[model samples]
Structure formats: structure tokens, C-alpha cells
Target: MMPFSTSFASRYSSAAMLVFALLSAVAPLAFSAQPADNPQSPVLPKSAADWRHAAIIDIDEAYQLSLENHPGVYDTANPDFLKNLQAAKAAGLALAVRVEDAAGYVAATQAFNVRIHDGHAGMSHNLDAQQLPAERWPGFITVWRGDALYVYAAETGGPSVGAEVLACDAKPIKQIISTNVFGFQGRSDEAGHWWVRAPRVFLDRGNPFLVLPKRCQFSLNGKRSQDSLVWKALSQQASKWRTESYNGEQLEVGMSEPRKKLFWLAMPTFAPDEKQREAYRLMLKGLSEHRQKFLEADAVVLDLRQNQGGSSEWSQSFAQALWGKSRVDRRVAAYGAKTEVWWRASPGNTDFVTGLVEVLTQQKQIEGAQWAKIQSEGMQAALARGDKFFVEVEPALPGAADAKLDVKLDVKADVFGDPPAFKVPVYVIVPGQCASACLDAIDVFSLFSNTSLIGAPSSADSTYMDVRTQLLTSGLAEVIIPNKVYVNRPRKNGQVYLPAIYIKDLEWSNANLLKTVEADLIRRKQ
Candidate 1:
């Protein structure tokens, strides 16, 4: 993942400008704008057919990179995975051939990404490449609730909050969303994809391939009505509100006593920035200091609704702190014993890992840097040995003589420090947005006998892991590809963890969420 840098836009913009200048020099006519016959008419450049053909070549390069370096290409779990990818590539090329402008190109690429159905495989355009005319939105946004879409936010005179959206553009609302929104921005899990992208169903985010709705039907107060959609430019505040509504309120790493015997721990993010790392350390320290408080509580809610992903180590460390290092380690060891991992030893993947070592070292993440260094060296060694993959299999437990290991292990003597475990009932609040490291947290927490998962089902990821970004040959966009594949992982690829207690009617606001959980705990006790 890219670090949070203030100058990222400027740096990318500069690079885009350079690329644009080069393209102009190579094809001056393609770059030059032709004046319109009428002054009021919009001046248009030459058809982007030539540019589109060039982008097709770039896509071909991306396809080759995925085939050579991405673990997903070699996924045996999904027999049709490679076929689907090939089909998506063919579809994208066909779209590129027919597209007349940048908007169509964007749609074609996004459609390709969505069709792949992998969260880790996607394209990100550079800054200037995204400077096309702004996409308009109807004066409201909708969210999935129960089996229906509801108006979550709106401009003045738009649909009222809680109004059920029945249809848009004379088509059933669900059909419209599935066609326009999901068709362009969907990922692995259905619930998760909806949770993350449904809010944009009414907006056209620079995809001119689909028609924008001009009218919508709503059902409110037992009265059905069709309203003319007033299309308008989305204000910055509205965009912010839409994001917050979908993601729920932002949270920091902290614990709160929502009730006399209920503790709510907000772990909104596990992002691996230096600040977040320090915050996690402090949170762990706080947990240790208030260990008794958590132990005595009737329930402890570990809220991960807003967490997307980061380093999995954060979740593992949290588990170690709460469940005791020895217990956590034993479970982790057992899990690892059954799993195997293979890193693609392609030159590009090896170089990416080598670069990560330097980046992690500069960020003061010594542990991460060391891990990257090891991976880099292993990949280099594998390449030298003419091996396609660097394989690793976990060692068996002390007495498991029947266990067959695929790789040699450097076993170290275990020094067990068995801290007392928290005996209170624990609940992990997972929303659909929980993914990657967030899912890792669920993996660790689920190992405990006293813990239960609640709320919506979490998003899923394939065996592919450890992604690296590579710029396409066209310089118009970059592709993300995963370098390693996990074999025999406990959780199957594209599998979601369904909450033990699913609260379909629960509102995501902090206050309401706490109240609902508290009420649920009360009912459980009764």
C-alpha cells in the first residue's frame, strides 16, 4: 500500500505531464485539439482510437505480469480462475477497441477489474489521468438495509431519510445498482462489495458507458411516489457524508465502558503508519493496565466495523495480549502446521520485495524490514536455483510424528510465558467492510472458545497475499498483483465469516450500536 504522503498528487502529476509530453511528441495530431465550427461548441481532440490501442498493449503487459508473477494465476482452488481472467482481458480489449474517449476507457478497465472478482487485483489511474469532466449524481445516496435500499443521505428537497428506493430510471433499483455500480466496482464477497460500493449507485463516477438516472421511485410513509431526479454536482461535504455513512463513524484505538459491565473496544484501523503503530503499542499497554477491568466485565466488544486492513501482526499481538502468548502461539502453531505458502520467484516480485525492505527500514519498522529481507533473499535464491516458487511449510508440533512436512524448518526451542487469559465473554463486531488484516483479526479471535462474531459477514480474500503495485507501460494506470499464495489455509478463498448473531436491523452509529449490543447481551442473559 502507498504511504500517506502530502506530495503524492504533485509527484504523480509531474510524471503524468512528462508522459503526456512524450505522447504529444510521438503523435502530435492525436494530442492537438481541433477548434469547433461554433464558438459555443466544445473543442474536441482527435479520436482516442490510437491511444486506446496503445492502452490495449499496456493491458496485455499487465496480463503477462499477472500470469508470471501473481499467485492468483496459478490458483488451483478455482479451476476456472485463469479462464475468467482471460475472458476479462478479452472483454477489456473488445471494450477498448470500441471506446471513443477517456470515460469509456475508464469504464472498460474498471469493468475488467470488477469481473476478476479479486479484491487485490485492480487498477489505479494517475492524478491527471482522472481529470475528466466530473460525474454527476442525483441529489441523494442509498444504502443496503435488510432486503431493500434506503435513502441514507440527500440534498434539500431530495428523498427523506429512511425512504425505501424502489426503482430508478424506470428499472428496479436493485437491477440498476447491480448493472451500474456493481458492474464497475464489485469485488470478492457480495455483501462486502455492496457495503463498500452501493452508496455510489446513483452517481456516475466518470463512466459514460452507462446512462444516468433522471427519475427515481420511492416508498415512504406507506405512500409510493415517483420523483424527478434533480441531477447536480456532488459537493465535497456530501461526498464526505456519504463515505462516513457507509464506513460508519471513524474510530481510534481505545476502550470505552458503554454499560456497567460491558466494555467496547474501538479498533477502527490497523493501518501500518508509524503513528498507528505507536497507538497500537499504547493500546496494548492500556489493555494490560486495565486487564482486571476487562476480565470482570460481562462482555467485551471488539469493534472492527471500520477497519479495512493493514498488518496482520496487530491482530495477532492483540490476541496474544488478551488470550495469553502461550495459548495464542499454540493455536497459531497448530494453524501453521496445516498450512503451506508459496512465493512466486519472478524477477519483478523479487525486486518488489527488495524495494519493500528499504521502505520498511526507512519507516523504522525493523521487524517488517527483516521479514522483507528474508523474502527477498529467498526469492533470489529460488530464482538462482531455477525454481518457480519458494515454498514454506510449517513444522509439526512436538509429538506429531505422522505429519509430513514439505519444507525443512529451522525449529527454535519454545519459551512459553503463559499469562492468564481473559475469561469474560468476548464479541467481535464485524461489518462487511472488514477485510484483509481485519479478517486476520477474526481468525485469531475465533480461536478463543469464549468469543463470538456478530453483525454482518466480513469480506473475503483469495489465497493471494502480499501485493505490490506496478505502473503499466502506458503510464495511464498502475496494477496491483499479489506475489504469494497460501495453500491449505484454514479459511478457504472467497469465504466469509458469517456472524454468529446477525443484527440485520442494527444501525451503525456508535451510540445506537452500543445500545443494541447492550440490549442483545441483556436478552442473552435473560
Candidate 2:
């Protein structure tokens, strides 16, 4: 983490320079420049501001917007409304990237291709997105068999890739994801490549030092396979992961240490009650005091895939103490015009006008990698304002409730200082269980150049608003109504994840998950 200089600043044009500047913090992977699929096709967006508009509007904004414009419309709706929404989304995708600077997403960009029905009683009826013809990255044999593990596709190349995860490192894949895979958890396809992580816990294996890095070992078929796979490193690739007791009680701290300039802290979750505020500070203090230990390693892996995020304030503080990069400053963007309309349209009369009095109207609110980040930044000024500016509205009128309403609000405070430089590339491990404020952290981490998403997608995107209204329905009788967040996104392509890597569960390979990944990483380290 030293001062840096651009080696090729003179060569890039202004636009390219901005692109470079925006992405320089990211890896050197070239941007699609053109959209992933439609290269050379001038499917330009009518407004360049559209993508920027989508990126800044968080779930709070989208939900508030939806309550205003489309009252009471949750995932359940009339077929045509869904149809039109899908159609409009296609147009948006064709017009321009709805998400700008959304490159470098590991698992989010390309993970899940198949969509299953609401019920997943068995694999027979479910669909795996990776099986879709379009999603198959030609030349690989990845298939999520009914068993849940990816096996070799008969047609694509064989499963002869130097390393095949025979098992989930040490633990069974069934055991690793079983607890959280239930329910309407979401997943992505863009955050791909958990294959690179070498941590043995994920692989559940103990490979000899001879089989490191690629963790290649000659298989019974006379070929070799990757001895272990690191799930935490892969979470940044888009899938989320975390470990817990079979019954869901909190697990204890595992391996964390200072080696060669890094401290690989494998945290299980961010449950607020788990550790007192002072305990957290103590851990940070230890890491800081032991900076020499951390600095010795080249990078660090803060694995939190299975981590159910709690205490946004606590999480925010922890992240601040860690990398403390420029994530806060650069992430600020304007709230698009339409966002204002959606806010005022909620079911009730009074709106966020009072709450938003301090910030610019028709503007985007500040968000850091954590929730209530304003408090963490020591911005008592903004915190003082946040406490004062809240909207108290009257009940909705029976007759007027059905129509659309819209309001505009602005955000004017800084919650995070900026994305801080990490002494090492931090690999954020996430699973479908990691969500809400946790997802907020993911969103921010994705913006940094040195992060990766590994593990399965979290459940946050599946309708978990902080404030929800229970409604009447045939099946559940009463349910959470306004809980659904409206992304203004058309239905079809609006699924949560689009990842950078794709992983076939280790059960498919008949290997241990933890041992496999550990063996792989140990081999690499050697």
C-alpha cells in the first residue's frame, strides 16, 4: 500500500482515461467495451445516465420508489404486468448497460442460468441456469446433475481439468450448503471462478505438499484433478459460502493468523450479539498492533460467505478498520429523476420529505460498505441530522391507495471515507445466507479493484425489506406485502446474480469440499 502512479496515463484518451480510472482499482481485465454478447451492435441506451441511475439507487431507494409507483404489486401480479415489465427490461438491456461500471463481478455476471419454479421439492422439476444452451461456456464439462454437484457434460470436454473437486474439501457439499440452500434463496452467474481459491477448508481435503496450487493429483482415470478448492476466495467470484453447526447455532473462530504480511481471518458471521463492540475493537487492535504480522503476507482473505450480516454499524466499523479504501467517496452518485417520483407514491400520505430535508432532493443517498455507516465515519453532524430528519406519515386513504404516487429525495452525507487500500487482496466469501446489510457490503466490495465474490448467492434479494406489510393471499392467507423491493428492472433478467465464475459442487467429483480447497491452496503456497 504505497503511493501509486499510472504507467500509461499519456496513451489513453479522456474517455478511456475515465474508464481506466474507474477500473484501474479493479483487475486488468479489459472491459467488454461492448456489452458481453452484443459486440459491434449499436444497441446504445437512449440516455447515458440510465446505468449510473441504476447503480446508485439501493434497495431502500428502489423499494421506496416501487411503493410509490406500483402500490401493492409484489412478486405476485397479473400476467400482463409481468409481461410488459419483461418487455421493457429487454429494451433497457438492448439500449445500454442498465448497470454501469458493473464489470469485474465474478459470479454475478454468469452463474445461474436455469430458473426453477417456486417449489424445489426435488431436482427433477428444478432448472439449473448453467444448463441453458446460451450459458454454456463452450469447452467445459460443468453440469449440475440432479445430485446438485456439477459433473462432466458428455459432449463438452471431459472432466480432465488438472484438478477436479472430488469432494467438498473436507465437509460434504450436502453439509456445506444444506442449511441455507432451503427457501427462496437467490444465486448469480457473473461472479465466476471459485476454482482459483486454494484454502483447504472449503475443499475439505489434506493434499500432500507435492500437489499444491493447482492441487493436481493423478486420478484413477490416469488424469489429475485439483486436490482442493478455496470457497472464501471464490465468494468474490459471485457464489456465497459460510460454515455453521448443522443445527444453525453460532460456530467458533477457526484459523486466523499473521503470516508473511497477511492475516487470513475466517469469520463465520456478523451476528451483532455474538461479540460486544469492545470485543470487535480489540480484534482490530490486535490486527493493527500485529501489523508487522499482517504486513508480512502479501494479501488477506476475510471470509464471510455464510455470514448473516448484523449490526450494520458494527460491520461498517470493522470494514473501516480493515481496508478503509475510497469506496465511500467514489460510490456517491445522483439519484435519477424517476427515483423521486417513486418515493412520493407510497401507500400513505406523508412522505420522506422531512427525512430528506438535509440532502438535495431528486438525489441519491450516501451508502457505504455497511449500514448506518454515517455513525461509523464519526460524522456526528450527519448522524445528528439523520436522527432529526424522518418522515411520519398518516394512514393511507382507502380509495386513493390504488393509484401510483411519486416523490423525490436527495442524499447529502458521507457514510464511508473512501475505499481504503487493502494490504492484500481481500476475498469476501458469501453464500445465499449472506444478505441485507451484508449484501450492501457486497455491493460496495464489488466496486473495489481488489475484491472477489465466492460461494452461492445470498437470500437478501428475495424480499426481505426492513419494513414490510403483511397481506392476504390464498396460500399463506396473510403475507408481507410491500416487502418486495422494486428495482424498476423488468422481470425476466432481473434475477440477482450474474457472476464471474461457475462452480460444480464437489459432491459431483466425489471429493471433500474443505480438504479439496485446502489441499489446493497449501500446494500453491508451497
Candidate 3:
């Protein structure tokens, strides 16, 4: 009836509905029950003294506000979203006993966000007001090693590397993981990534809020090591140590070795500035020049570990350069998932006009005649007639209700460039933390049989994006949330994108990981 197409309907579960709601619309909901912040707002605490002098009520108010505004928990139709909120609430009951003052509230807020486990959902606090854990955990760097938390690196005091960590601060490590959740995006491996900073996870230097214990008790290799923490505000202590900086390069290309026939490329993020954009162009130009060489290389390892995401344009462009001039039928091979309108944007529900325009344009999925009609009718009129528009697809996996939609849209074919597709086997090495555009690369690459994923599974691919930042009613803190939601390939409740090779021992050190992968590549060549 509304330009619906049955061509692609069979691929999607019936329950998927696409809806759009901006975070700004919830400003009133966040502040309505709380005191408003303005020029005359309460003067925020300036230091630890000021924080001590400040009222605990303010911190509580901010914490409550963040909880109410968490998009994953508050307004989403996704059933999993609420479980996070429930977990946080249950954890809060235990935390309440520990919260003594404003600092406690800040810690509670962070714990709340961590429990939610969506990387995009986070709280920003006033750093000057709260005293942060200045020093890091002494000796060993703890990480989630496979299923258990283990000491992956040693700087000074604790167990040797490879020893399993039984507990911390007298609490069993498994118990800690079960009670307090710390992670990124929607994947457990990404959550493990945050755990790698263990005990460090409790320290936020600038936005001093989370606090760690003065000492941690560890049982490693059947022996207990009591590691005492020496706290120093790292910012004040200027040490001679210098860590290498990757500088957020969007696209990096090179070879593992001069003698090796393997090529290496790392794309940390796709959100590029002018320089990064130019660099990507230059990379394509370079690839074009060495087209034959690249095609002839034994294999190409595309590193997507640190790619937190950016514009999809870069992903598309890269695919064109590599895959070149391929045609994909969206109705068949590419019908990964679908979006359904779970909520309408009428006046009774929300600001109808804004909602209609966003739903029509945000996804870029709707086009041709129906899109033009919506445009001609204007947003207000379209809302009156109940017309919905969607643009490009977002991230979402099929749910139980995804199969029953009354109306559906035909997916468009994805057509690439005219260049010769790079026939070299492409190995996508994703050691988790990949999202947004990085997932976009996976989607496009999956179409080719030559492409294979190696290393750890990725952070759960979030179709939900467009993070909206809002200052809390306290003015001392802000909350960041993603207003958009996407559908993804259906997965088990806790499942993630598992790599084909499934390298369990990959470490945080990129150099170490590269060496491991490089060795495997050389063996493959043999």
C-alpha cells in the first residue's frame, strides 16, 4: 500500500520495525523531575575540597538522570537493552552500601554505564571536582585471557606472565566479572578489552570519579601475591616514559617484510579529517600504481582491530578498489537484516514532524517514487498520512518478531566500480573493537569467497549509531547515547563475530600480534 515490496520480505524476520527518535526530544524527560541548570546554576565543585564541600544530592541527581536517559535501557524496543538496565539496577543495590559521598555517586554512575555495556553509552564528569585514581595497578597488567582474567604483562611486582588471576581486592575475579560489567559496544570480547585495563578500569584521571583499592590480592599459579598500589596522580608526575602513538590514522598500508610477499593494511578509524581523507586517496593511488603487485601478493592482511568506525564512504571506496565492479543482489546474498517501525511519531507519541523527517531520511533506504512523494507531501503532511521513509541499512540482527511485517521494501543492488577485482586472498584480522564502518567492511567483504576473518571475534556490530551528547541537569556531567538503532545478523544471546582462525592467545601488543599473524601468513605461503 505504501510502496511496499515483497521481493525482499522473505529474508527478514517479521518483527523488525524502523523508528527514529532524537535524544534532544528527551531533554524535558531528563530534567523535568530534577532542578534545572542555568547561568545561575549551582556552582560546580572545583577540586576534591570543593567536591567534599558540594552536596551529595547533586551527584545522585546526575546519576539518576544518566540512568533514565540511557538509550539502551530507556526507550529502545530491543529486548536485550532492558536486561542491561536490570543488571545495573541489581548491581546498584550492592553499590549503595559503598557509596559514602559525591565521589561514590560518580563511581556508581560509571558502574552503571559499564553494566549497560554499550560503548556508545557513557557519562562525562567534571574532572576538577572529583579526585581520580592517579596511579595504575603496580606490576602486572591484568587482562581477560580467554575465559578467565589473567596477568598478561608485568612491569614490576606480581606474578610472571601467563599466570591465571584468581581474585582481586579479596573478591574472586569471576565474581567481579559477574557483578560489575565493563565492556565496549555489544560484544563480550570488547568488554574483555576494557577488562585488560583491570584495576586500571577503576581509574579515570581527568574526570576523577571512579576509585580503586589501595591494594589488590591476587592468586596466581596457586600462589597468592598481595600487590600494593602506589597511588600518584600520573598527570602531576612527569616521567621519562614515552609510549608510541598511532595518531588515529584512518588507513595505513605497508608490507610485513621486504622479503615476504605479504602486504599489511591497518585502518584504525574511518572518521577521517582532511589529512586522513587525503591519505586514503593516496593509498588508492598507490594501490592503482602497484595493482599488479598487489594482486600478485600471496595474501593481504587487513587489520581492523582498532577501527571504532567512521564514514561508510571510505569502506565503500576501499571495496571498489579491491573488489571492483561487482554486482550484489540485495534481495538474496545481501539481505542481512531489516528494520521495522516499532513506534510511530504522531503527536501522541512524539514530535511528529521531526520524527517523520528523520525516519524518512536517516536510513537512506527508501528511494524512487515513494521517497519523492514523501518529500512532496512535506514532513508534517507525511506524518498525517502515516508515511515512513528509510534510507541505507543500519546494524540489527533478526529477532523473533522480524518475520511478520505486513509491508516490506525491495532492497537495492549494490554495484561497485569497473576496475578488476583484487583476486589475492584477503585476510581480515580483527582482534575485536571493530564497529560501524569496520563492520561495513566485513559486510562487503563477506560477499567474496576469497575474504576470511581471523583473530578474535569483533565487538558486537552496532547498527545503532548517531551518538547524541547531552549535558546533565547538574551541568557538572553529561551523558552520551545513540538515538538510532540498527538490525544485524541474528546471533546467540552472547555470541560475537568469531574469526575463522580463532587465535585465542592474541595479546594487546600490536607488534606481538603482527608477528604471530605474519608467521601464519608465511606458513600459508609455504
TM-score of each: 0.82, 0.39, 0.65
lDDT of 1: 0.67
**Candidate numbers sorted by lDDT from highest down:** 1, 3, 2
Give me the candidate number with maximum lDDT. Answer: 1
State candidate 2's TM-score.
0.39
CA RMSD (A), model 2: 20.5
**Ranking of models by TM-score:** 1, 3, 2
Q: Residue 492's C-alpha lDDT in candidate 1?
A: 76
Q: Once superposed on the true structure, which residue ranges of model 1 sit more than 4 Å away at CA?
A: 1-47, 128-130, 354-374, 384-386, 393-417, 503-507
Q: Write the per-residue lDDT of candidate 2 for residues 421-459, one digit (tens) a residue.
A: 454455555544454445545654554565655444443
Instruction: Give the better candidate number (1 or 3) by TM-score.
Output: 1
lDDT of candidate 3 vs native? 0.47
**In angstroms, what RMSD does candidate 3 have relative to the true structure?**
8.9
